[model samples]
Target: MGKWNAKGLELAQKLEGVTDEKAIKKLATETMQEIIDACPGEGSIKRPRAALRKAIESVYPSLNAEDNYPQGYYRTSEGKGKGERYEHLALWYLTTNIDRWSVEGDEGRQQYWGNLPTLEKTEPKPQQTKQQKPKQKETVMSQLNLDLDTETQQALDFALKQSGLEEKEFISRAIAYYAKSIANRHEVDFATIPTEKLLNDSSLAKLPGRAEELTRRAVRAISIYNDDIAPENSERWAITQSAIARLTGGRAKSIQKALEDYQGMIADHHAKYELNNYSNRKSGGRTIEDTINIAEL
Candidate 1:
């Protein structure tokens, strides 16, 4: 209703699932408190009792009763609509926005559940039958704004027409081609996180999957940063970092450094490796997994 509450909702988007009711509530309370701290004029100091939960519920409204009351968690809910919707929302959101934090209960093997479309958790995956169905690839949607000169646009349109493919498909192929053939020569501009420290020396299981997940997030952020800027001036990326940042509302210094480093990588690549077309002609945009893997590369 007020500034603090509105900010509270924005903060709630950052919440991943915690283990139990107590943890969730504590997280919710902390989130609300953060909003209150940030929005001094919102007068959230007098925010109602359980106001934090109410604010949090605004984000995950299905949260109802805790599976374990008092000492336990606010993690589980019993009601049909609220709880079910929460599960669906969480699964869809986490899988698509893999960069987002995940729930406590949904870690470990449960993380694999993200691969499925439905919220329904299957029983422990039965022993692999000899006759295994091909896994279906999940889908993700991204939107972009791009600009091109009339001639380039005409060329793009002509190519798409000749290929009989939609804009997204053509774009996907072009991006894949450029990355593999053109962009793979040099070191990336950003550093990736190391999860080796997370690995247990004694446990054969080694490190938890979260390490890989964190790496994926870092990779995604860099990929997104590169993709989101100056589509029209792509050819001049080496010399146009300032323009790119101005257009994209990003820091010019950062853009300059990334573009220069990437260009250096390309220049260096020319010395050692021949360009690789890596041809595997497909009809359209790849599966979501393929897209993510390409970005990682």
Candidate 2:
């Protein structure tokens, strides 16, 4: 692109605040026509210069007048290395409008050959090393409990379907396994009624687990105790006490008693057990230190 010349600069400076594109184009066209008219001959460099000036003026109104060469033209491959094609004309047309650039910065300004960088290429960063997770020990029950990823779960479902167990039986066993898993969450050993007991024992057939039996008892105890002691007190707290009673055999109820009474005792018993479990767990085996020492002796 050829740099904007004296005539183009002067025209651009003339129309600084004229924002309308059509108006600017019109002004540019008229100014170029005037410059051409002023020039002596039709095919003179003066005519092309005037046209170039007009285009620059139209596009870049706020061009720096102090600079000697604010814009320039270069040759294009089209038109057999032409003098100045329509594309060059369009460049002049677009570049002339300084308003096309940002208001605060020189982002729209074209980089010139003088400012081209000669810096070396930067090397890429090394890839990060990912640490492998430690391998977990697998037991039969552990494998059974291993979170069969969703894919494995589907496979297990299919495998279970192929097994001779009925769908209902499968569900029962699954539920029992699930309950056992929950019961094992804190400690490896805690006195707990077996799933077989729940299924076979008439008294416990309806009970899900010790905790559940406790919960039922707690709820029932709270309901009853609230009536006997204070109707407005905490039912949930009473229920918790009932759980403790059931586990310790300290509550004044038999399993043969009303459902509410039995449920209360179970609740009281479980609550106390849970509290002790929590304390023992937090002490990091210190809670049982004396017992361990005695056993060792």
Evaluated with TM-score, which candidate comes out highest?
A: 1
RMSD of each: 24.5, 36.3
Tens-digit lDDT string for candidate 1 (32-120):
32332233232334453244445555655553343323222223333465452233222222111122222344353255445443323
Lowest-lDDT window of 10 residues in candidate 1?
Answer: 133-142
What RMSD value applies to candidate 1? 24.5
Q: Go through the candidates in order and give each one's C-alpha lDDT.
A: 0.37, 0.37
For model 1 the local lDDT of residue 131 reads 22
Worst 10 residues of 2 by lDDT: 128-137
What is candidate 2's lDDT per residue for 84-162, written digit by digit as tens? 2222222333321222211211222233222333222233223331111112223332655656688976776564445
Error of 1 at 252 (Å): 21
Give model 2's clash tally: 33
User: Highest lDDT: which candidate?
Assistant: 2
**Per-residue lDDT of 130 in model 1:** 13
